[model samples]
Target: MFLIPAIVLSQRPFLIPHPLLATAAPANASILLSGVLLSLVVIYLASKCGAEFSKRLDFPPVLGELVAGVVVGVSALHLVIFPESGMEASDSVVMTVLQWLNGLTPDALTNVFQSQSEVVSVLAELGVIILLFEIGLESDLRQLKEVGSQAVIVACVGVAVPFTAGTAGLMMLFNVPTIPAIFAGAALTATSIGITSKVLSELGRLKSKEGQIIVGAAIIDDVLGIIVLAVVASLAKTGEIDVTNVIYLIISATAFLIGSILLGSIFNKTFVTAVDKLKTRGNIVIPAFIFAFFMAFLGNAIHLEAILGAFAAGLVLDETDARNELDALVKPIADLLVPIFFVTVGARADLSVLNPALPENRAGLLIAVFLIAIAIVGKVVTGWAVFGQPGINRLAIGVGMIPRGEVGLVFAGIGSASGVLDKPLEAAIIIMVILTTFLAPPFLRVAFGQPEEPPANGEPSLEPAAVVNEA
Candidate 1:
């Protein structure tokens, strides 16, 4: 499995007169595959260990995965370092291992390094698509409908307040540049439905009036957050906001989501018929993914984020008779792919920017402090947005929306990839995500009067948080 470099080196003289060209050819492909496999090994170990430790501590497993990634990433071990961070193949522990094992030439090592990074990045992207799809499945449209206007008010306020307040404060108070400020502000908009829902379930309040409002608003918040992310991510790429592009994204995202859900009945019928006719395995799930990938492709093709399409696909399928079965089938796939997404997000973060010793790093530390304040206070105030609930626990509704969770990480990752966020700013966004995610569960428990320990009955776990790499 690892002899490709040896085979190539031994045959190089006969195959080509130019050593450099020969080294850059198919040799890197073989090594790239090896590097990716080793990277996955490290990623899985970190994810599982981190998740297991976090679970024991009563924290979200996703937090452990992020911290674990930081430990193995450029922030510490340098075991899974990337090329974009100005690191060479020699900087990566994985690459060093491969070199020692295969006796790679310097030229071949560089090629393998770049190729390996690209492939891992692609896998991380796929992991997010799967994560969004699973989120869609969990966002029950029926529940969303039943919850009504109060939830809508809460969700709108949750998105608008933080976005407006965070962006303006960064620009006005901190003198930060516009695009980066917008990206950071956009990161604050997402409320992790998965994490909040899990907490509500654990507290036995998933059926409470307040619980229903929180869940419903969070569902709406996810949709709005994706739209906001799509717009800001596009703007980040261009480094300037184009009004036309923003309007187009907003309209297209809204239209795509509404269109797909509207047509869901017709699609669901065809989907069921196809699944029933197939005697082979993956009958239902296969068709579901084809639709998902197709929607994701359309989203990208239309200049929107691919996740929007994947999300819309999930919503459409959520209405089907096969919803529960599809949810069960999709979980294992999500488990395999989603950790790669979370770990990579964690790995890319450079925590060194948060250090207070350096004069330059203080700005980042302050930004992080500012963002955390905005993240909590902005969402917490959304509780007051709930009108006509007479005696509703408005504080609980707001607290539930506070955790940015996996969804916030998605924003930071995209912003970093777009190169609009400087290291300091990017690190600040990550810190805010981590703090808000960690704080939400306990704050929620207190807000709800610290409900009893979850019952021992084997009732199907309402903790969908575990499914999405959040809780």
Candidate 2:
């Protein structure tokens, strides 16, 4: 009877337990819940404050959010670090606070920390998915169709130039091995559609001709990046490329995008009819999320990014009569979630690798500079790759492609995990990603010309109307 009571009380830690029960009480669940809630509070506060400050400084708000994440993250405060980044529970200030407040043992703290980081990571993933979906809805299908060829050319050039040049340069100049060189080259090929699109949307240029071409190219770039990653990752693990997997990714990616667009009309009509029948409160928005999440699920299930499916879903829904209402509904949701994506991307970037004072980092810093130069020049030239758009903002298009963002980090992470990249090479790739990701936003604004003066209220008025009305 006493044993049963002690077991019950241990699980419910809030209750005042007998002396034996108190020592056995495990608070991992409650600690996880508390840590997650606190993490969210930090995320939201940092996001809004960073965005507001950036906006005031005449920079893209996303850049501010990224910077804010860097401040609170591992490099500085240690408030929001991740386990995958090789950080421990003790390294996290938030975890420390929770442990102190809840009197958690070290073992319990580790479990709570891991669980909390995972929840935040999942939230960040969803944030990007929602952001892409919003971008899709704002995009005009006809415009995308018009610029499809140019976008393809840009994407192809962007991938080919960087891969060839970076791989050959690394092997010849740095005396690097073939596999690691190939991996670094592959890292250069990624263009963060999320970052570029968010910046484009903020600049109120999402519907412009240049914007269409950039968005379209970025979409194709993502698909191509996935294929490159698959090939290189296979090479890393087994020392041979898997042709069968490569072909499957190519075929499936192409089929998925084309098929999604082709069947969009049918999906739209069915969606509208369903919304008309539903009498519930979330009749419109809830069903929309269901389709979006399902499409996202399908994308991940097939080895592609979930954002692609969400984006494809948005394109389908853009044809619906409910587009306007749906856009309004989604904006608040995006505002809430999208910052998490941007902030986490910033947080994961460990800037200590760039410190040249350390003997080990000096070599990596030199390689990073070379990679950065190549990264910029390779992507910039893609602008001139456009054949038909005689008067397009070619420079803006090129600049838009510069940010490697989270996609580049994925390459670095895989390289590190596979044991193909040494410290200097891995640090070089990460530094390259960090520089490219930070530089693009400010440069992109300049490429488009000086930003317009703000209204009396001081906000840039980044509504959908602004997106549609931009020249």
Candidate 3:
């Protein structure tokens, strides 16, 4: 009778157990939730701040987003605090929720989350592809033609130097496998064209000779980066480097470029002709998106990056005629989706694990700093590639492409997924991403002549020139 009473007392709702009992929920779920919430809040605040800040500086709002992330991440404020004790508690809660949602066994929650992460990753990839396509649509091919040789030189120099520096730096510091080092090098090759373009536009130089060169070079850089990625991925899969395969990839990329332009030109002519004939009443955005997706799918079929397809599709659209409509259709989707992409990036950054105290960890941080320096120097060097143009600051143009942007993160994600990068290496890359992105805007404002304050007469002393090529 006494034992039964004790058992009944233990089962009582008000019964107090150990203090630790209150911490039984899993911590990872809490951490994830915190990260998500914090990221969203930071992005919102940063977006507002960026609008005003960007007027005085020559950079995109994404730079501000990166700065906001760094502030919340381990780099600065360390605000997204996750206690070690909370991990078990958070895990338990997450497991229970997962089991309830999918009828999964306790043992299966890990697998379920992994599966969910994969799905999210695929969608993120799709988002990037669409983003790239939109960029291509906004691209001016005529500018590329005009800047052809100079752009080629700038891109080649830009890619080669940083890639070599990154690979060598990793090999010396980490002693990692050759393949992983190669991937690391490849990751350094990207230039966030969006950020560069935004800065150029802000400086009222987007139509200048230097601006055209930077833009053209950025497009080529994307092409080169994708080709390198394909080769690295193929090597990762095969575990052996095949010279013939690498050659084939290059050839295939070349073919894709030529073919895409030819096909896109024909398609653009036909589509615009149809739009004219049909006088379609509804918005053409859906059709445009469909075409973008179609091109993305085609690129995937060819083992090319889906973004290439989106870009080709964009190139096909007669931007001169359809610019306003296309912009209206795409901008809304971009506005909604792009922030999610950046915030997701911040949320996914596992900065809590990074320890700068340990030698290996310190090495990783140093590697990040070294790579950033290399990235900056490499682009600056490309400015010297401009010949017979003394007035044009090729250095400024090259420097403009230093920020790695979304594509760099995408590369890091691929490396992380492929096991080419361990957690520390991944963390290091994230730091590099944040640093390059955050530094560009302010520096770019200085590099490009800053816009003077408006005159009292309501007209600025210097008027922004219309779209004109500087000889």
Candidate 4:
């Protein structure tokens, strides 16, 4: 039996001798495969580590993932090493082996990794859209009606203050032209509602009065963020911020929003009614995915982020009982896809260009610090925007909004791509991203009075805060 097994193994295709033993081609192919496999392994292991870290630290898992990337990337540890001269020499044979794997069809390896990166990016974009949509779905529009004025005031102030501080800081510190600074500051105006919501939920104050105000303000913040982004993008392309164009963008955005809501409401009724009539078997997920992609595509056609459409779709679903079922279905996919978004953001962050020795680099770092300070302080002040209410801690609500997470990084990416920020500035923006995300959870836990120990007898000890029902 042993002899037969040996013979079978020897005869396998994988065990066959290389026909081109003398060529460099085979060695290169081997190298490429190693890199791809190594990247995958790293991602999986990092995700596991990230989950544990988040639980232990009481922070968002994204912070853990960023740490994981720092370990693998050149920014910190040189775990994923690629040697020059096309010759691999390292203490451990693993680096050599990875180099050999990467050598195999270098072009093919490059193409494969690029495609994989793009796939992850598309999913990440989808995840953001879904996240925003979930927020909209969960939103109480009636609450907005009650505190609309307050929300608008807080959001406007929040956007303006941070933006001005960020722009001025960038311009003075980096000595960059005015246009880029304006764009950079504009990027900082948007609040990442996901991070804010996560912190609020952890604080056991998701239904609090201040929480409601923050949520309302965030919706306005997002709208303003898009407008600023559009204006900046136009300026980047045209080399001047046109007042006429800005006016047009504002009008267009308003129409797009109103149109999306109206159209979404009508489509929601029609589609849900049809689905009810069809009495579909199994899960509604596949159809739902199709519908989501279609709406995302439509949003793109309208010159808006597909996420806007996804958010609209979610709002429509929120009006129906099917929202719960859809959430259940989508949560699994979100779990698998969302981490890729965070990790990819980290992967794309190339910090090597930021040499602290250089004056420009040092200046950029200072600007980053200043802007981050403003970003945090500005939102914290907005907590006071919850007016006509007493006995509520507005500071907690503002603190909850401190983290920028994916959205802020997305804006930084836009600036980098549009030539509004150099590599070092981008690195600085990422630092701010990491800081805000890492800090929020612990602060939230403290603010909300989370007990240090589990309640005895497994009884729920904490009581929900009094609901500040303005509506």
Candidate 5:
């Protein structure tokens, strides 16, 4: 398949007289197009190397991609520095990597790359949207329904304990105001469902009873996390949290989710027949992918995370007859983009917030460390809250829920952008997320015991018949 720029430029034009020519090369040369492409190459290479290194050490590949981003991002190498700091970036020995590859001095280099990050960030968000959609495609609604009660119970405890603990820890001890405290607490919610599922898949236990429980609880946690983020973000954005507005936000989110799922599922199957009449053959997932983006846009308009909408779209289509074909098409797209999302997320972390020389920042660091502890114990306790399934190892379920990778970053990123979470708090949250994310795979590995080695062929093939063209 062709790369992304063509898709991004579609259906858009510049001046009325010069529409299609807008995409043609400008009269003067610019290095930015080449720089961004090279940046992606560096990012992909760094991510794969890091991911493989982590896998060799019995860790999840997500953790490695994240670390690689930080190592090569503004936080470490200053390979992709901002223009303001580029003048004084010489202290970083890793700056040489950027110099040797791109062949530009720091300040000039930064100016060239800065314009590209905004575009890269937009693409990264798209990557995450695709990931959530792919996850939804793979999930079974009936299984989620069966575990609803247990999931609700565990999700509530998981959200509540950490939120209260995180908020209070920041407020009472550090004298943090109401808004940042709330953002800090909200970050602790939402166990990384993608990370947990990956670990379970590695262990080949996703079909197990324990795995089912964890998946259900994580879904519920996503719902609860959305509500908390909505409420807290409202308080931060408006500087006033009315009881009625909070109620309205909750009701609106709930209604959107329920209505989307019901109407989406109905429309998915019924409309496909009508759409097919105008159809070109072998284009099943084109409509599915477009609908996923529409839902994501709708969710944003309603003040919830886009992933929630994308996820709902997944659930809507999972029960349809076209599920298999849609999944086959979307998986490759997800695979191509998901690494960019994860790597950019890590690389964007600004480690300067934790500098000890800044007296005020020290308190935030302490609060971060404290929040990490609370985040772990909070999720761990949920395992004990499970009612049925006596044979299930509750600890494994708890450990599975520990990683807070992408979802936690989404919450923190919004808070930082909205001016609710300051640099220290945002950086601290990033550290806490990294630590929490790193712990989960090792914990799951130990809890589930060692995995057996693959046969002489190394591993089985992933390509299915549907993924290949039948000439």
Candidate 6:
């Protein structure tokens, strides 16, 4: 009969409807999208609550963000499961409970978290790119020139001492490889100008010579840090550590930066003119972002990091008539993306590594504690190096530079991505970042001798201080 023939045809492999087709094609896509949205909401809420609590307790908001990450991340409550090959073979008690509760196999759970983390990672990458671009936008060549010699000395000393100390310490004490140790040193070199500026501004010392020196030194430190990152990342990629290779990397990175800036500066006006002819003048952000992405691509082509390209893009645009407009438009995007970066970095921290009962975990904890001490001492030493400002409180300046904040986290994230910083090491790095961020405010307050803020007669004083963004 016709019914029998139809049933036989339907039973064939090709006759079967696809699962998504049976529902809607977007069913899987919707689930992934929903998962990402829900995850962001959760992370944002936790970060806000944590930050508010920290502020109430007189700590930086980043401490709260890290706390939020640990609470939801892989090593703690595991609320945000990560898919790792390790998880497939893991006899982890927590993983078992999660698997059973979710009615999934270990493999399935790993796949799910892998998918989730991938989405988060991409957003986080964007966050760092936007951050560096903003920094480039804010760098006024005149201001840096004004600070001049003193700032240069501080930056050089600050970078050299920490780079040497961190790399040597990690290598000698932890037996870490040359590559990982170098990356750790690079991570230690950043001074969070944004965080330091806030404390100085609150104390009404932002216009002080010490403040100018600190800001100038910090700007220099950023440029140095990025270059160092370039060298280390290059070495890690090449798996070479000789002096010849080292020199080559440094020269290459410096040339790339110089070339990109010069080229961008030369053509920026023409590029803007062309873009202005487009419909995006009403929202120039579109062209602004395109330039950033294009530079990023060029950086990749030149064996430099995309971040440098993004930074170059910002440097070029900073000179344009639309500089302020670009900042205004890009800032909102950065605000949304930057927090996602920090929170995701925090989530990557392996809290299990801090467990005292496990031998390895206890060792990791010791490493974390040691790193905190070194991180503090490393930056504090630079405060004393402000020889030009003999009257400046060396202690205050050093304390001001101590907080690693977002910048340190960015370094750590890159190290991990490059396979130089393992889970235990990254956890240690995160611990250091959190503690330094928390400690700097209180230490800086004491160093500055907590002034009672003068009453504001109008709007707040218009003085140059660190740009304290939510990032």
Candidate 2 stretches with Cα past 4 Å from truth are: 1-26, 451-471
Which stretches of candidate 3 lie above 4 Å from their native place?
Answer: 1-59, 69-127, 169-180, 198-205, 233-239, 277-281, 350-355, 358-360, 409-427, 451-471
Q: Ten consecutive residues with minimal summed lDDT in candidate 2?
A: 1-10
lDDT of 6 by residue, 113-175 (tens): 445456666676677677657655655544544666777787777788877888899899999
Most lDDT-accurate candidate: 2
For each candidate, give its TM-score against the true structure: 0.79, 0.91, 0.71, 0.74, 0.78, 0.71
Model 1's TM-score against the true structure: 0.79
Model 3's TM-score against the true structure = 0.71
Candidate 5 lDDT over 1-471, as tens digits, reads 001111112111110122111332341014555555666777778778888887787676667777888787767875543322222435333334445655766665444444445445666778877877776776677776677688778788888888898898889978888889888888898787766765665565554566767877776676677667657766877877667755765687679877977786678767478556655854677778778899887876765657777878888888888787787788778767877876775776666665778887786687778888988998888888889767778888788778887567666767776788887787778778877876787788787775433345866422222132110
Model 1, residue 121: what's the lDDT? Answer: 69
Lowest summed lDDT across 10 adjacent residues in model 5 is found at: 1-10
| Count of backbone clashes, every candidate in sequence | 0, 0, 12, 13, 0, 0
Candidate 1 or 5, higher TM-score? 1
lDDT of each: 0.74, 0.83, 0.60, 0.58, 0.68, 0.64
Q: Candidate 4: lDDT over CA atoms?
A: 0.58
Residue-by-residue lDDT tens digits, candidate 1, 1-471: 000011112121111232232345676667778999999999999999987997678755666777788888878998887765658889999999999998999978877877777677678778777766876676666665566688889889989999999999999988989998999998898887655655565456765678778876775675577557657855766655567755775687567767877898899899888889998999989999999999988876765556667767887898888988998899889889878866875776666766789887777789999999999999999999888668889899999889886566566666776677887787788778877766787788779885544348956545453233432
Q: Provide the lDDT at 8 for model 2.
A: 19
- Residue-level lDDT tens digits of model 4 in 234-296: 687787666775576557556765676667667777667666776557346666666676766
Greater-lDDT candidate between 2 and 4:
2
Global lDDT for candidate 5? Answer: 0.68
Candidates by lDDT, descending order: 2, 1, 5, 6, 3, 4
Q: Give the TM-score of candidate 2.
A: 0.91
Q: If the candidates were sorted by their TM-score against the true structure, best first, what order would they fall in?
A: 2, 1, 5, 4, 3, 6
